[model samples]
Target: MTSGAITFGVKLPNLSPLASRDSILTTGTVAERLGFTAVWASDHVVFTPTTEHDHPDRRFPVGFDTPAVDPLVALAAVAGATERVELGTSVLVLANRNPVVVAKAWASLDLLAPGRVLAGIGTGWQENEFHALGAGDRFRRRGSATVEFIDILRTCWSDPSDGFTGEFCSFGPIHFAPRPAAGIPILLAGRSDRGLRRVASHGDGFHGTNLNPAAAGEAIARIEKYAAACGRATASRRYTTLCELDLRDRPVGPDEDHGGIHLVGTPEQVAERIRAFDAAGISHLALRVRALSGSTRKEISNRLSVRAGVEQLERFEAEVTPLIA
Candidate 1:
């Protein structure tokens, strides 16, 4: 948990339909070669197009027709392809799957990759997804469920001898082997008070999204306060953010405003923004290129070619990493 140097991670292009397994592997390999610290995959079990619901964050819309690669599977692919970069889930909805199954899968993954796996979890916002996964009953209590799930995961990973009994999840003492070599670090994702509180209590770090440097700094302070209240040491708590990257030399529109949450503008500008985040106590910054303007999944996929994605990553590595490192 020692800290000082800022680390950077790139989100694998798993959201676009055009992103094939080969493309995902290529992005991860390129990131590791370029000196990135980690590569992240996002999660979504299912997207029902027929459902009429606006996303909680109106800025980013989720199209049901858009294909999303399974986070765990995608990360496994990246783990096999790259030997250095940490494999991460940007925000895996923990409540969607059984904690026991998740613990086993992650434990095996940790063994396979040794200390290069990061479990970034979240209490998902999609009610439909929960219902689709047969976890509708647990959806109402997701906040508590997430906390309990983490507890279960830790017990299963660190001490199988001690069985777990909780409101949502209970399991008898069972043999779980091949535990993580260094123990996987759990990073909670979200900007809500409850989410931050969970990070303070149960998480080893905070994974924030849609936040500017100033906001991330403030959030870190809040997490420290909550951690202190919970009688937990906050000295080594990791703070990371997922920011939209605009590699264009000039601002395109209101979306690319200098003061906005996204990291937009020239490579130098982006590097300065990374420095600001570092000053804010953010240890890691996960960047994703902004999606092109497209109403349909096909249109968006057409805009986000594997070549374009790789080029953007290369640009950041060459122009921004040097300034930050």
Candidate 2:
């Protein structure tokens, strides 16, 4: 397929209940049924405190508050829920996970799903979550850790004569069985120089998340620069951007602020906007079904729930999917 013709995926942040896995299971099944190309989850070990005084965009509604299930465990469940959709992470925080164990977990999932694993990774943002895992200072070195981690994962999975040693990881001369039936695509998340450079140098793909269409050019440009610097071309390197949708096209009230950057119009407009990203060099657009920011109270009860989110998904499936497909 042409880069623009490549299928789209979806990212789910905090979709599962901390107490149970059923919510996420249901969501993944629904997304697959809707014909989403892939399903991804976030990696977070703890929740930062949310208070009324904090910005509304920073806070998730109260009932939605819960610890995340380990992504590998969640993906394993998703593997069984759907046959065609790919399974992935929006960005797994490698700093918080043990590399050896993570390699095994992901490899196992790939075996279950075969050629359907997309490995999205990041350095992560929350400091408290690292502390909870006793990986605080080490988390600060996540960029380097991720490079080493991926190298180790590939190393352990292949038939190797010896192990590896690095400041962040080490393993030796042993057989790691059942490598992914097909190679997993490693999509790195971040937009800065170091991040883009790392993606170019090592990653198989790039995850451009929460970027406005206007700002997307700069990120894509950055990727092109780094990829060229590494003697690769943008066309050869895989890339995806995540776009959030709000159903309104223009301001209807005080709550309508900043929804313009979102895919907020009819299905055609959203499709055109997504096509723009593809034209700009994004091979996939990982979308989420939700509105952008507004009043905290309104956001908490009115818009941010699984029920509303699914309705939005149905709307996009009906409208945007056909246009894009």
Top candidate when judged by lDDT against the true structure: 1
Q: Which ranges of candidate 2 are over 4 A from the true structure?
A: 1-6, 13-20, 48-65, 248-261, 291-305
Q: Candidate 2 residues 196-215, lDDT tens each?
A: 88888888888877666666
What TM-score fits each model? 0.91, 0.84
- The global Cα lDDT (0 to 1) of model 2 is 0.70
TM-score result, candidate 1: 0.91
Residue 128 in candidate 1 has what lDDT?
A: 81
List, residue by residue over 1-325, the lDDT tens digit for candidate 1: 1124788888887865655788788888988888888988888888666444545334442455667888788888888887888988988999878998999889988877889999999999878889999999988889999998999889889887868889988878899887886789999987889878999999999999878889999999999999999999634777888887757676456544535577777877777778888899999988776542111222233355667777877788777777766
In candidate 2, list every pair of residues with a backbone clash. Answer: 163-172, 163-173
Off by over 4 Å in 1: 1-4, 50-57, 251-255, 291-302
Q: Each candidate's root-mean-square deviation in Å?
A: 3.1, 3.9
